[model samples]
Target: MSQATELEAPQAPRTRKQRQAAAIAEAASGHVGWMLLKIGLLAIVDAIALYAAFVLYTASEWVVLGVVVVVAILVNWIYFSRRHVPAKYLTPGVIFLILFQVFTLLYTGYIGFTNYGTGHNGSKDQAVASLMRSAQERVADSPTYGVTVVEKLGALGLLVTDPEDGDVWVGTDEQPLQKVQGAGMDGDRAVSVDGWTSLSFADVISRSDEVEKLSIPFSDDPNDGTIRTPDGRSGYRYVSTLEYDTAAGTMTDTKTGTVYRDTGVGAFTAENGEQLLPGWQITVGFDNFLRAVTDASIRGPLISVTIWTFVFALISVASTFFLGLLLALVFNNTRMRFRNGYRILLILPYAFPAFLSALVWAGMMNESFGFLNQVFFGGASIPWLTDPTLAKVSVLIVNLWLGFPYMFLVCMGALQGIPSDVNEAAEMDGANPWQIFRSIKLPLLLVTVAPLLISSFAFNFNNFNLIYMLTNGGPRFDDVSIPVGHTDILISMVYKVAFTGQTRDYGLASAFTILIFIVVAAISIISFRKTKALEELN
Candidate 1:
């Protein structure tokens, strides 16, 4: 037998099952996926703990938790991505989502309760609360003036001015303003009674301390001299027995026998002329919410702004999508030239920070000397940031410039992944390009891009930077109380109220924030449902 004949007794070939078994054995030897589950669980626990800590302590817990989450996800992805890549990549992002949400919630809650306003920017809470107490106490000691005086140069030094003296005299607080010995004086030394039109130092000083404590009789007390004002009653006002019950939410003025009930709003007023100013740290349960809902000023402009916001967002998404998709499709053609250069140029807008870009655009659109006005509207200004309609439209224009580049990039990536075979098959059936796009391409494209569309809408809804930077919600609308602007979105309006309003009422602002959150959340939920419906349809 030759060497070749030695292999004549051939062994049975290894089956697919045996090959699979061998591969598994090799994988097990490498300890592949060994720590994947543990790492994932640990990341999840850490993210939860961080969020809880933030809820308890606010902004202080994010650093450690963020680092741990990033490290864990990175390590797990490095090791386990041989099995699952997407879950590992998404782990860190999920943690960020939790952190962002917690921060927003805490911020909204903090702004809702304090008088966070102007001239009171940092004095949002404790500092402003001190003002009311200080004001109340400052008027406690009204000076009772015994005398008034004027100084002279010669032997006759002082002159006394008195209410009792038909012959006026001048004296100091130390010396009573009574009849003085001086018969005549001249020029600067003369304390002339002609200039004194009953407006003496005694009159002004008497009113200095307006606050006083007076005793009131429970009934008709003729025995107590008809319950008159105390002895030194010249310019002082007595405090009637008006009791304020914060718990019961009522104010009772015992003298007037009038009761002022807390209307659950900020104001407390009786059927009578009695009223109370908004005291410090008052938590008017649902007044903030009610004001947002029913305030006539807010209602009128709010409806218009809300409508514009939706319209603006819709237009933004549509224009960006169509334009981006068109650009992406054009770029995807094999015959296209300088593709890399074109891509870089197209993505440049997205590369820059959005706020900076918005500001640049705002300046360029300025009515007085902007390059845009010089080109289009000539010498006169266009009122880009002034008129309500023009400002809204201008906002949309700026937003479109900033937002479309991102959409374009996304569409470019998505367009590359779509197989040519589907298009070819449709073309073979004599389908036109538009028909193929409408029937086959768009449906498939939407499956990938719908989420991005929802995100784009959501982003535009609260796109505070663009609105703030470009127009600052101007020009002012005089119709409203406290001066709100035309293009003011809910967030910008909240900023005005909580951060820049007359009183810096953080409590009111917080209340507005909560309302806005609810509105935004509801909108997001609706969008999500719409997404789900599309997914099901697909």
Candidate 2:
């Protein structure tokens, strides 16, 4: 055949098997059922994201709303598109990682740099409103209005009737009083309003605390008196004790004649160093961090807690690892009788949840009626958890009991991984058992287990449950302003600072959290580098 004719010749048809495979791939790619499922799931996710965006918008959290919009758009683009198959598998995990891990860390870091605590948690507008609401005084000779309490959508409201004009209005703590049409009235008292269910006299009595505190503004202007119900049946007019001058940005106490001016520290301060409560959150560069190290009220307990945290973590890791390694070595022997039973018994502590075990230990160590003092020591009254030095010892002992089995399992696996030939060669060279283990076995075992030890150290550094449950982080420190104790580690201290006391300082707690992360990261990096030397021994 001529070369040009040969080049133009028809190719052989595809084999039946190859054609079948191609058909299957095509069908799989365009399957209606699979496509429908993907569409349904993505639709649900988008719906949720849109709802979240709506909520954020209502709260004026524009930054979070923008992020949600971007993420939802990216999700739709990645899943619907045919390109980036690997990304299709990875997108869910990546999204979760960003939401739970990266976003949380970044938010915490931002809080650490800001005044985001009890008195400084909301916008300035909210703070001003709160100040005006909190500093209210009853207006003398104010005419009382007949009123009835009502509820709508789990929110409480007051329906008031003007005795003279017979005009009825509905109002809530958040919403001002507005005239309502078709209100059900009973002898000049508004019994109910349209679109709101009237609360019965009995129901109103049951929520007396809420009813007494409910204050609804008479008008949009802050200067107007609010309608408040002292007895849930009658409403009275009350005006704020502090008068706010909006243009001048100052609050003047009408009765005392003292003025509080904005000092740019998230609060209005008087000239006498008195600051108002419920101040707004604002960015304060390094103030929380500086307070931790400089403020005497915080610095003393913080320094002591930091030192104890390091010591507790170090001792817990060392004690647990040593005991675990020793037991692992003994049980690893082939001729040991009932070794399986012994191993199971050793792992019993780990099999039970650690927190439950901690509670059990706490009960056993109680000074008043504890097993240790009563049974073991014949009522000696030794304080296992109350005394400072004794409490530290007790924590270490309980942690070792709870933690050793894990390390034992790790060491047992690592021991099996070590080659028998290396030990035999040392034996042939006439080295003693100790020398052989030191030179050949230990170094090799460390190659596998050193990383785990470092992780365990980090875990025990923030071992909050043991400290919190066992001693409640106390023998008690009387001198510190915040709630702190002798046995308090950094994490437990952070917990006390953030949640336990009346004054919750979230900004300070977040700063402590960041410090903890830095400490753990630095230790892990350094230890991992040191473990490289053990890897070389392998």
Model 1: per-residue Cα lDDT over 502-537, one tens digit each: 566566668877876787778778877877765753
* Shift in Å, residue 326, candidate 1: 1.2
RMSD of each: 19.7, 4.9
lDDT of 2 by residue, 290-363 (tens): 99999998899999999999999999999999999999999999999999999999999999988899899999
Residue 33's lDDT in candidate 1? 75
TM-score of candidate 1 relative to the true fold:
0.57
- Give the distance in Å from residue 271's predicted Cα in candidate 2 to where it truly belongs: 1.4
lDDT of 2: 0.90
Candidate 2: list runs displaced more than 4 Å.
Answer: 1-36, 144-154, 158-171, 177-209, 230-234
